[model samples]
Target: MAEPQAEVDPKTTEEMEVPSSDPPENDNDQDAETPKKEKDAKSFDLGDLVWAKMSSFPAWPGRIVKPWKNVKKPAGKKAVRFVFFFGTEDHAWVKEESLKHYEENKATLSKAGKGAKFTKAIDAIEEAIVKNQASKSDMESNEQSVGTPAEGQTTSPYHPPSDDDDDDDDIFLKSISKPTKDYSREPMAGKKKLNSSQSASSPGSSPRKGSNSSSPFTKINTPLASPKKRGRPFKTLEDGEVAKKPTPKKRPSTGASTAAPGKKARSDMSFLSLNLYNSFQAHLAQKGETAKKDIKPTEKKIGFIGLGLMGTGMAMNLIKAGHDVTVWNRTSEKCEEFVKAGASQAETVSDLVSSCDITFSMVSDSEAVRAIVFGENGVLDGISDGKAFVDMSTVDIGTVTGVAEAVQARDGRFLEAPVCGSVQPAMEGSLIIIAAGDKELFDECESCFQSMGKKAFYLTDTGNAARMKLVINMIIGSVMCSFAEGMALADKSGLSQSVLLDILNLGSIANPLISGKGKAILANKYPPAFPLKYQQKDLKLALAMSEQVDQPLPVSSAVNEQYKRAKNMGLGDKDTSAIYKSLTH
Candidate 1:
């Protein structure tokens, strides 16, 4: 069937009319309202100071002789070039288009600026003229005072102030009346450029024998200096040598005093202190930016050592979280599991540490942890001052403390984060991590641990995590042993294991471990939720720690002895629930 077409309304058609080809014809009126281009271009004045780009075309130490402008030119070209002259006979012609507006204002421009050499000369001439005028006025006053004498006599008999007069005028009169001597001594060492005119006037002047002009100090004996000398008056050595009078010491330049306090008073210590402060502030700002980026999508390079059963799953979670993960294991074959899940493999501990920014180790026991941490090719060899190392193994408190000290000595950060729960929790990414280290390092690496665990608790010291892990596993061992004894007693009383488990589940005796692993134990299933050997190690460490702290743990010690018997019987390779077999036997 054909579709029906709707008719367009007249008002809607007019609203959608096509635009005209030509623009609106009020362009002249708009231009008249707008300001002229010349007026805009004349913003800069003759003496206005501006900053130009420090570039090769204008050269270094260059200045603009003219300001920016817009000049009409031939149709083909749209710009007029301005002249800029640099020192050392260097100059360039730059287009007005190439120049930008100067940042400084007219008041800032110096009269003795780059091309204004005449400014200094003009100032000197004006100063000399003022000095001459003052001297002429003083001389005219003196002549008038001397010519008009006392009017007591018909013919005035008067005299100028005599040098021998004991009056108030003696100071000025005596200094001028004293006749200067013409004493001239030999020019001493390092006086190579004695003025010829001065030496010629003093015919009695003679050289001091064997004194060379090349030495730094010169010794000369003279009374009056020749007015024709060009250079400054430098002192000459020799007692009674009335050499050329010394020039007054120059005050610091006015330009130096005009500078800001920060610029004026500078020392090596101040400069270094300021530099250090600036560097620290810059680093903090960079870290803040990095933290913001981390909250978004970030690629972290993670190292996973000891790719055992738990390590494999934890490494997999990190990979799923889109981290760059590298794995290492003593057995070497264990890394293949994570390698299949897109992880890079490290042949040795050093390889892992050297490649990653943060390293995670989950080895077997205290000894295994030590081997990986302090061996020749250990993580210490790869760890650097800025790198962080995390040990997730259940070990003795002493071992953790020792490893932490070693890492600290090397200027590396250390975090002991032993986990609770076994292989199942590890696989599900639900392990509980207890961490201890520097607070900043703990906070920085918490997210990486979160990838493998449900939550992490930061403690105070490196030994805290190790002690906590031992305490938790001691409870697990005691509880598992109790359940084993109860089950054995029930079996001997002719009650079915299923009925006993069901009854236990209904009562307060039931717990997650008892319900979950007890069912498996009742069915004779021991797939190693927690390995028996590791459980035994944790029990041993806890017993020793308890003894040291003067705390009693009779049940944990008994459970540890049973684990010792099980280990001796070669059941150490079995799951922790195999403790029941040891108890029943």
Candidate 2:
């Protein structure tokens, strides 16, 4: 039996309260300390490529980039780079310790890193890096041509000395070079220092990107300050040549990215969602409507795939909650009921994803998940900038990560949302949603989740939801098997089985699983609510997960065999309480 979950019924979604925070920089930077920096003393130069490690993922081939959506200084002040991973459409301010030369993990730079599909990203990043370098060279040449400007004529903004010249800012992380500058707290030359407005519109000044670009802003959770605060304030000359000045005398630009304020751009997952949200709010403001804090956001087009026992109930709840739902299933017949119930039907998964803003998929296993998502005209084909994909199926970490990468690589948001409940809870909109990935998407889908679940928690990362779901179901499967066996023993001892159930239900052992399944067992009818086969499947997956960490699970191991035994006895399709029949037979 499971422990009682929290009944979180706050008036508004938690996202409304927090508005979401910075990405997991501190968490990922734990291993990026001084010791690791000391271990690898080699310095990286601009356009220098390396293999950057992120989370537990395979080290991806990344280029040392001076321009990214958010170029924050890396940890330990290591000679690190904000690496833009070529094939994966991901970027990280990786520590020098967490990176190695590209030749380490990869053999050679083919057009394809993993496969031909990734060739586009590889070519794209390479072109961007080259273009950036070429642009810098051009700027430098122009600066040399211009020489010094007359006192009043602004030749260009100041350019800082090269990375080798400055130990105080060794990383040369000017997008955030040598991050210790502490832009907001630190002052620039007492009172004569320019503010954010001056940097944005000042004569010959270069603009900085988002303050959110700095993990420091995220750490402090403050609104963006002027980019001049982060990097040196540079002014564009009439001839477009930038000059250099001594540090502490006047700040100098790193000449990393040409982009300045109002042109702040990011090409990651947050790029689309954040821009969309800001645009929506801007529209409301332009119309003189109440601010977003008070205004209810427009609902997203909802999509659901799989119309099995659990999927059906969940989809029906979404419709009943007045969502504009479009549905798809492997079996076409199952979609008819939903179509008749004010829901629209999609001809294929691609069509479903194409038409919807957020698509929810719940399949039996990882293989089925792959077949739909990776199949022709599947999710990969349909994913675009404005759409999000939430897979609520019970799956392993590998499958979840694969789907997440594929979707994000294409600029589509993905969340692993394996639910914890069966048919009854699904129909009642009382399932517990364990979701991870795309915090922005989670915030946007508040109403849809509220309609489909009793409570939904936004856990961290992409694979954690699957892990949590597996562990929960593992316990449920083991307990149900134990319950089934105990009932069989009561009957064999010639004791009253009904009385035994009453005692257990009345005592500490009582939970929805035992109490509900116990009644069905007593009635001798095991209609498939939570199928025995699926229960066994969850246990099997849990066992596999345990093996990865080298943890022993003797109890779950034994329980899994019992489930297999029951399945062999043709009780696979029946409700889990039918495991009693396995004991009896």
Candidate 3:
């Protein structure tokens, strides 16, 4: 060490100081430093975006307004607080622990281009507030000097006079006394006096002060400038009087009123008058004497066949829409109710098809639909070019395709429109109609569809609508079976059936069908809104169609077996929810 050591510089040795054996401590310095460190640890800067919580509200995005402290608190218990602003006018004072920096990944500081603009504007406003406060204080201090009155003036309107009894009495007398001269009686020098009768008749009439004669209240003998007339000028006689009657020059009829000569008809009239005029024209039309241009052509005649549960409501809606509807049913009695509701009764299906521009059929099954279309005196026999046939029945794809081909072969248009709702939706005009084949025919029948359904979807191929219906029905059947199985399992587990339904309603699988059917199943009441047998038929058709395309539907096949079991148990006429009863019993 001695060999390695080099000579130390005197200036470097003087810079180094030796430590004291016992360091002198100042409590004031240590205490002040501790507080500063704590305050710096808890402080947040202005304009910093943070997440803050209010007393009862959830944590929301906010920005720190300022560092605040409760001065009234005891010294040691006192802690720094933050003033936070949520939006333009909402602010809260919260603890330091209640606020944190906003995570950038979770949320941005603010919307784009808005944060910077808001901060700059807020800073300007705060500066203006400080300046205004200072100006207010200065003005208040100068108020006493500015408010002092000048010599020979009173601060208030009223001033107490010198102590003089005579002066006070004179002021009082003058304030109470009326004027000596009456202005109403005094007339201006140039104005003429109005007659007593004229003055008495015109309550507000008075002479003009300085004019020669012109006054709205003055009665002058001078003739007035005539008013500018609108529209055509009236013909006058040689004596400058209006003519009693106009010359008979022919005027073209314009379906408007004509005023007599020298008289103007009012332009404003109530809507009742217009409605009555329209009614009179309609009456003339019915008599075949109205103007050709004013007459409305008759509505197209619409025909409805197979007035079953669904078809009856559909036909009624068409009649309600003001179509000239003709309805036919196999039972013949079913048409009576519709006939009473403004629909004409047809003795045969052929008569209905022949008379109507468009004919709609909604039968039970493929067999019934085939009989109604291809049988003698059926739709095929009556259809001609320009005629349209729409089948609203749910049937197999092959059946609908066959009917569509037969219809087109006879020079008639065909549309396969199977609806996806039950009797209630049909009655309410809220059915979902799936239509395919003949785009022009679909467009032509759109108005009729609107009257009977909520929405109509047009598929391009003939069999697509039938396929869609089958697929939807298959899903509906599967869902109902699953609902039933869940209900059975819940019951076996001794859980409340109603609570299970409520829980399901709160979850993802909740739907209108499930809610309605679950309630019905719980009550052990299955009325036939949709019969079980129909659901079974749709499932069978769906399975058969799936096999044709080599696609397997295991879930649908299982649901179909459950529906079959329910049907075999004599619940076929009950609602589709009856499958729940099969599992329970």
Candidate 4:
């Protein structure tokens, strides 16, 4: 199941608190700690322990993972900040009173019982003072040995710490690790019993009085607080995993249709019901604009053909945006799906051509598109001098140019709008629409396309859309193939398939495709989100296009071979990630 997600808010990490020993009336202290003067502080202060008030509740301790004073900035400003490793987000601001000089502070405090309490308390106090002094000495040494900044002046705010600092190699080597909570996943059912009793008794809820005891700000117990029951638990990416981009949401029905021509759609499918009412109301409002040439509605009628995965989604948006739509598909079955959902279906290409103000085509490929639009019974037979036709198919640049010429010969306007995305993007109305051809036709169709997609880019020529589609798909193929190779190598190195996935998930190198499809690949689930055969076809086309342009595409060539092999093995209809299985075999 896809994880539940919340809109991410940017969080600013809080700086660690610095203890001050100045008198309460020392108004000059603020000026003394000028951002510049603070930069000049060469030694760490060993002043009396002063606690900063907590900003938030349920106090949790932040480990002073690395602390520095008089840290020379690249621009020569001295900073006296420390980096703290907090286990949870809640207690990031709450500073602790001095008691945390050592791990034994708690044990020493526990011994303060009856007659032994006096001596024990004295010992604890002395230890804390001694540790504080030692820390001060170390700080002084660090300041004296500070190195010069990389540049005399800095342009950016963030810079690396100087090498004079301790050689804690782990600090540099460690990846930014979040806990392994899948934030996208929905919470599991069933309420968990809260540790209400323990929490009520815990000092985390209350401040300790008097003695320098950091009892309220205690270490967090990682195991108990997780895994969170709702939403994806934040999991740290492994060293090399790439960050995954969120998948776009499916487009809202908005009272549109999902009914296919002949299939009985679910009763809950309201697209048809709502859109039907809308279509009737819209039809009435337009009055004589139905077929009359003189009276045009606010939005002109746009003809759309090939109501498959891509076309149907785009057409629905066009209708939903209040455009008068006349749709046609070679397969009469496909047209019925839209027709039943309130879109009027054109029974023949001539009818769509003669009637449509502007038409968009999203057929399977170049051949089908050519046949539908230029054949004996094609759109051209009925197309007039000023008609506009937009083709949104991934086809050869040559084919696009050919279609452009043919449509223009008939005196009709033409636009090639091969989109750069898949089913999910199309469904989500987030597909990137790339257009080429007559500028006027593009402008005319712009609003209708916007209703179907998030972005649209117009190219100077008609074939650029085809070229861009090839470029984008080439990258997709290479990335998927590269991931497959990496997974295969990891599996062969003795890691379980699941463990390999986990490592990838934790690393910065993991891509969204891997995490989203990793489990399915492991379980051998090959439901075609994007068909394997179609991917192979695109790879072949991309490589062939590369060769035609005198471009060297060795990486794409190799990936294409992999997909071809997978196709040959009869995995063509499965998901593209099935390439991993082919590699293993």
lDDT of 3 by residue, 248-349 (tens): 111211102222354322111111111122222233334453222222223677888765445655675676566778877553333433544456666567
* Candidate 1 lDDT score relative to the true structure: 0.49
Local accuracy of candidate 1 as per-residue lDDT tens digits, 358-390: 889876677667777777677788888877898
Q: Give the TM-score of candidate 2.
A: 0.50
Any residue pairs clashing in model 2, and if so which? 157-235, 172-177, 173-176, 173-177, 174-177, 204-235, 204-236, 205-234, 205-235, 206-234
**Candidate 1 residue spans exceeding 4 A from truth:** 1-298
User: How many clashing pairs per prediction, in order?
Assistant: 0, 10, 0, 30
What does each candidate score in C-alpha RMSD?
43.9, 28.7, 40.9, 25.0
Q: Which TM-score value belongs to model 1? A: 0.49
Please say which candidate is ahead in lDDT: 2 or 3: 2
Backbone clash pairs for candidate 1 read none
lDDT of 2 at 566: 90
lDDT per model, in order?
A: 0.49, 0.54, 0.53, 0.48
Clashing pairs in 3: none
The best candidate in terms of lDDT: 2
What digit string (tens of lDDT, one per residue) describes model 2 on residues 114-202? 43323534554455445445555665867754332221111001111122222212111111101111000001111121111121111
Candidate 4 regions with alpha-carbon error over 4 angstroms: 1-298, 499-511
lDDT over C-alpha atoms for residue 98 of model 4: 24
Whole-model alpha-carbon lDDT for candidate 4: 0.48
